[model samples]
Target: MDSALDYKMVFDALVVPAAVLTPDFVIVAVNEAFLAVMGRTRADVLGHLAFTAFPDNPHAPNDPAAHGMQVLRASLQRVVATGERNALPLQRYDVETPGRPGVFKERYWSAVDTPVLGPDGEVKLIIHTVEEVTDFLHQLRRYGEREVDDTRTALEAVTTNVYARAHELHDLNERLKRTAGQQRQTMAALKEAIERQRRFVFDASHDLRNPITGLLTELEVALSEPSTDTHEILSKLLRDAERLNEIVADLLELARMDTATPGDAAELIDLGRFVVEELERRPLTAAVHTRTDPQVMVRASRIRLARLLGNLVANAERHTTTTIEIIVTTDPPDAVLEVIDDGPGIALADREKIFERLRRLDDARRKDPGGSGLGLPIAREIARVYGGHLYAADHPTGARFVLRLPLAT
Candidate 1:
């Protein structure tokens, strides 16, 4: 059993009201104690700007003491600027009555804001902790009015002790919660890495099995038959060997793409001109036409982008009857490129399936027996790595593969 410390559990267990905020003062999270004290739910406070969530009482906007938001903001800013803790004095911050719009209740609090510094010694987050002292203040005021000086003094002493203890407890809880959130994120990433490794192994073994078995069977046949045609046998063996090499090459390319980081060997290219030049450099198997807009420009690794385009065009050529159309244009923020072929149109259900690694439709298998199914998947991955998208969109009479890339500024 995994005995991981559940930081969320510790955070929720905190009895003192506490919340986590970004350096910009946006509420990132709030503990259960904070929710209970504020009469709020997590959904009501999380992701909201701190001041926006707990605005000053509009009914008492002109009252200097009632501007609790200003006090809190000043304290928070002090912590951020100094990278130190800022303890606020007793504050009169009123809260709107839950389920009663426009009705605010008078409240007082003793609060502290502490900065969580990053490696660069800059404030990354602030831990805000508060203890409500409204009831105690009211009682103390009553005692003073009744001339019970001794009792009022005793109550003030107790309140001081309580506030100090609450501050210590809340700071500890906040630290635990932060550590737990980071651990959870790390575990999630590790799990994803493991899953990818597992899938890669499974795919490699499954695809390699057929070619290896065929090669062994062919060798056995050549040995057993004394009069077997040497030239024909060698030719067939060479084709099988080449097919094996292609699959391995495709697999390696996919693995390389999986680990590749962006901006490696990247360059700015005019989309239309690049497409025209690439097509001219490569021999075509079908009649290819282009309607490219020279104004469309993008930043990408030239080699990877060329491979992506080649994969799309090659896929189209394999299934095309006679013609292939390539279109490059701009759609505001994106540079759009479409490779359309006058072939059997892909069914809606199979459109997404084609992009899956080693996934080939029945027609695709019949068209090119030597084809490695990694082409489309690699193309899509390349597009994704460069903050782009490649998908099979609906076509009137054939398959339409569209690539949308963010246009370079």
Candidate 2:
């Protein structure tokens, strides 16, 4: 009896919610725990269907229960044939008493069914065991919700980033298009200016040529006529006309200098020599002292550079009434030629605007314009072509013109 009871105790300890159903599908035996859960004694539960013993489900163990029992029979048949454990996991109601409806009083059941075979090689009984798994199911539901939220957040972030990048690209393209259009407009304006400059030069030359030829012809006729009071009058007229012809010639030469092309420039030029040559050629009332130092060479177009210096010296000679001094000064990054004269000084207010074409500051000079009003303009254009500039300096004594050119190669 002790040995038989020992086996029974061992089996009961290993089994959970253990019960046995007979070959005819009746609840033939149940463990002490199973009977306690039903609130019944061993005799009361024995020989009843498993559902009737529990009263939560009354059709089970007579006909197989719908949930696990339906799947259990096939597994149990295989178990009986092969002599191995067959498991069918399922859920079922295990209400404690009449007070509980859908809610179980103390039982939340997850069940697994296994077959118990007879000596005749058939399944005589089926064993069922259930565990309460309420906490485990709650954890599964929480994990599922977190996964869904994380996915939604990532999708929203990607969409917003794409929208921002698209807007930035659109703005950059618009700015690039505007810059290209402005460059095109600037090129068109430069072309138009060049065309107008060409037409002006052609017309000025044509108008001045006929009068110059007639004046020269009339001067020859006067020299042949005899010396008398009438001859003196004609002589004065011829001399004035000759001066006028010279002025006209100077005007035409200045215009030609304005439109001439720059050819190959020499590698180096002597600044002192250029100033000396220009001063010797110019006829002036006052002597200009040359402080030019010959060693100081400049990188310039020799032809254009010579003409530029001649025009500037002549301009100073025309303006100054008395003494003129030419100074050649060198600086750290540039070579400067300054022509300082004792003449009617230019007004401080008009110094800046006087460098423009045909802008003589004095009203008397404007009316008695002896030379073509093109000397300064010609000088300025020459300076620009050689990467230099010509500007007037305001002074208390007289006007100052400074020419700045690049240093020698």
Best by lDDT: 1
RMSD of each: 12.8, 35.0
Model 2 misplaced stretches (Cα beyond 4 Å): 1-165, 180-261, 363-368
lDDT of 2 by residue, 198-239 (tens): 655664565355456656655666567655456665666676
**Clash pairs of candidate 1?**
none
C-alpha lDDT score of every prediction, in listed order = 0.86, 0.63
lDDT digits (tens) for residues 92-208 of candidate 1: 677779899878787878888989999999999999999988988677667765887767777667655554565456456556656887999999999998987787678768778
In model 2, the clashing pairs are: none
Off by over 4 Å in 1: 1-158, 171-182, 262-264, 347-353
**10 residues in a row with least lDDT, candidate 1:** 159-168
**lDDT, model 1:** 0.86
